[model samples]
Target: MSKDSIINNLFRVASNMFTQFNTEEPLISEKTKVILKTTEGRKELYKKIISNPIPF
Candidate 1:
């Protein structure tokens, strides 16, 4: 999948999780960090993947 798609999916998943939890402290502390880290990781991965182009 493309970098944009992966980032979009990450946001979707985070939103769904937050909706399900509906808590305050957990949302601010734990879940937020998790989502942020996941996004950052995806970005790094996307950069690496894109930098090294594959032949079809």
Candidate 2:
């Protein structure tokens, strides 16, 4: 409720969010990107995807 506590809470929340954001890996992994660049990679990726596809 004090001004100092409020500011500290805000800082703590912001830092935690930023730290989590920075630590996450990219959604499209490096190998996936590399595979997507070439036809062979595309075929491989497609096959893998179809092998265990979403039920829907």
Candidate 3:
């Protein structure tokens, strides 16, 4: 799968996991990108991809 697809899948799984536990905290967010990035601008695209507000 492409990078975008992979990120989306991650979000989907995370969102579901969060819902299972009933939390508003996003599974993926700016902070997560900051924490996961190992190189500059590498995770910037994912930041935009996750901008679509996930329903709670």
> Model 1 over residues 1-56: C-alpha lDDT tens digits?
77769766866786687778756556545654564468576676568767997999
Best by TM-score: 2
Off by over 4 Å in 2: 1-24
Q: 1-56 in candidate 3: lDDT tens per residue?
A: 76656665775687677767745765567776564454334366566657766788
How accurate locally, in lDDT, is each candidate? 0.67, 0.58, 0.61
Ranked by TM-score, the better of candidates 1 and 3 is 3
Better of 1 and 2 by TM-score: 2
After aligning candidate 3 to the native by TM-score, how far in Å is the CA of 44 from where it should be? 1.6
Q: Model 2 over residues 3-55: C-alpha lDDT tens digits?
A: 44444464457556766665466644667557666766656655665588688
Candidate order by TM-score, decreasing, is 2, 3, 1
Positional deviation of residue 3's Cα in model 3 after best superposition, in angstroms: 0.4
What range of 10 consecutive residues in model 1 has the weakest lDDT sum?
Answer: 27-36
Q: TM-scores of all models?
A: 0.41, 0.45, 0.43
Give me the overall lDDT of model 2. Answer: 0.58
Deviation (Å) of 47 in candidate 1: 5.8
Which stretches in model 1 have alpha-carbon errors above 4 Å?
25-56
